[model samples]
Target: MPEKRRPGGNTGVWWRLIQTAARAGEDMFVAPDARSVHRGNRRAPRTEVFRPCLVGRPGGDPDREIWEGIVLDLNRYGFRIRSFAPFVEGDLVTVQLMRDEEFKYPLSGVLTARVVRRSEAGGGLMDFGMELVVEPLSPTSRSGRGIRPAPPPSLSRPGTRMHLADYISKGRGNKNR
Candidate 1:
């Protein structure tokens, strides 16, 4: 039997409808950012940061070499940093949070954290999510007594500011004295 053709040529109505639906779906459902995927109901809350930081790994030797990074977010135990240097999961790292002009807080020490996740940020840079292998002890804990008091547990809470003494750094690596 011969096939019958439509009165006019196929304008691709079905294809057009599918395309339109796909476009609508794309618009309605946007993909979440890299941070969103890793930080699902985190045990510790993270606060957005604009502070400059140094993230370094052992370079050939145990001595730590620095890489410039912007601390995107931080908690007491971990941090999410963006840097041009790439770090792989389970890699150990050290961090030094540079003093900001606005806050003027000096924080530096060997973190000894394990990289939990690494996501590429555009422009040859990557974002790293690090979890501290061991929670840093307050300076006072080492000295037995410190002149400064410890800051409140929550850094993200409104009206709470971080103090120089509040910064935690623990364990000595070959890089750090």
Candidate 2:
């Protein structure tokens, strides 16, 4: 004969009690506050997420020496970067968006980010997920449309190596120490 399955197994009493409480409209457990709920929220704005990106560290030259990285996800608040090199927590970085190829121009922004989590998929490959503590460049505010023009070939030229230092020095007058 086939074995029979019980209607309730472990914690049946607990489940019954929970159902009773729910039916009574007296919450057995309190709901978390807005702040607590927000803490667990991982959803970001559409614009910040799923946008193509290139990430690199700051270097001496403002125009060169930035290691390129692809942005896997982004939000208005922060972004997740995928790069060969690992980024430590609290590291500052600059992100560039390739808007268009015809113009060969890139919309760039600078922000300070801290590494929140690191996942390794083997073969010396690591994915760095960071949270942006500082605000990134707002393309909308600068041009009044919030949309950026095409990226310049100068920014994404093939075989071009622009160090983070070059960009910093030229744009912010800051040099890597």
Candidate 3:
């Protein structure tokens, strides 16, 4: 005896439903952008930026050759900069935002910071995580000058740091930082 087929073949309908669900079950979640992956607990939210800046030694000298850098991102306590200069961790660097009329955000005049993280940004360039050792930069808004802030406890000794692995192992590289 031949097996019976349901009315207009409900099997095809059931199969199509399974197929649709299988397609839906696939990994369709969008991946997050690496640049905007800032976890909570930040003192201030990061502001996306493409401002030009000069990274140099922490001095008021006007005759020092400085590394030309572009501010990739900015925040209250820190910002990220990309430059060709191979600045080492714990190095004291000064970052001065260029006075561009097209891109002005009132963060003028030298910012002293410590190189917290270093990452290869391809093309012989590097990305430096700058943590502002100085804040509230100017005594007056229009002064555009800042008195350098003392280094935090960890970077008190400039040009001195343990290996990256060692530093991370000690939990200094936590998300909070």
Candidate 4:
């Protein structure tokens, strides 16, 4: 009979290589003074969900193909999405909400969002931090089908991110200088 290895037992020669690679997500320090630090400035609380959805450009560009992605976390203002395609900053995307993995039913026509942050999650996949860029459609348009309207001047076309404070300031007729 073969002996069973313990939980921490080394599998083989690649043990060191695998161990070092796995520490990336586990080693970020939140201490303000740390050389490598992490910060959480989110204003809205989020719900963690593993829902599938379709992502692509607005207006259904014929040349660009829509792709599938998983919503990692969602909140009122934004959500974090993981996809195989790498989206550039300032790129506007439309998310087609799906009922589930069966791909049989559609939940909503499309939600407009801007890619505020992007990071490589390895394995040719990427993680995107998206900010909802438009207001919800009126109840009359709530059949779960409506294209995104034109972006407001302050919200779109900015290479820099629009912080929550910026939004509040914009409401008071102040420009982000």
Q: For every model in order, what is the number of clashing pairs?
A: 0, 32, 0, 0
| TM-scores of all candidate predictions against the true structure | 0.49, 0.42, 0.49, 0.54
* lDDT by residue (tens digit), candidate 3, 1-177: 999876887897687556645554222223356344222234566788988888888776889768888899878889989999879999999888986634345358777899987889999999998898955444655466655577767745567667877767668656653
**Ranking of all candidate structures by their lDDT, best first:** 4, 3, 1, 2
Global lDDT of each model?
0.70, 0.60, 0.75, 0.78
Model 4 lDDT tens row, 1-177: 999878866675366446535554333234547453343335666788888889898885588878899889888888889998668999999987789797567887789999988878889989998999977578757877675787867755648877999878879997854
Among all candidates shown, the one with the greatest TM-score: 4
> Per-residue lDDT tens digits of candidate 2, residues 1-177?
997767766577676666654554222222445322112224443233444456667665778545555566666666667666656766766666655533245766555667776767577766777777764567677766777678866655578788987887888856553
Q: Name the lDDT value of residue 160 in candidate 2.
A: 75
Ranking by TM-score: 4, 1, 3, 2
Model with the higher TM-score, candidate 1 or 4:
4
Candidate 3 weakest lDDT stretch, 10 residues? 23-32
The lDDT, on a scale of 0 to 1, for candidate 2 is 0.60
Residue-level lDDT tens digits of model 1 in 16-103: 5566455542221124763332222356667888778777884557565678888898888788889886679989887778887342
Q: Give the Cα-based TM-score of candidate 4 against the true structure.
A: 0.54
Which numbered prediction scores highest in lDDT against the true structure?
A: 4
- What's the lDDT for residue 4 in model 3? 82
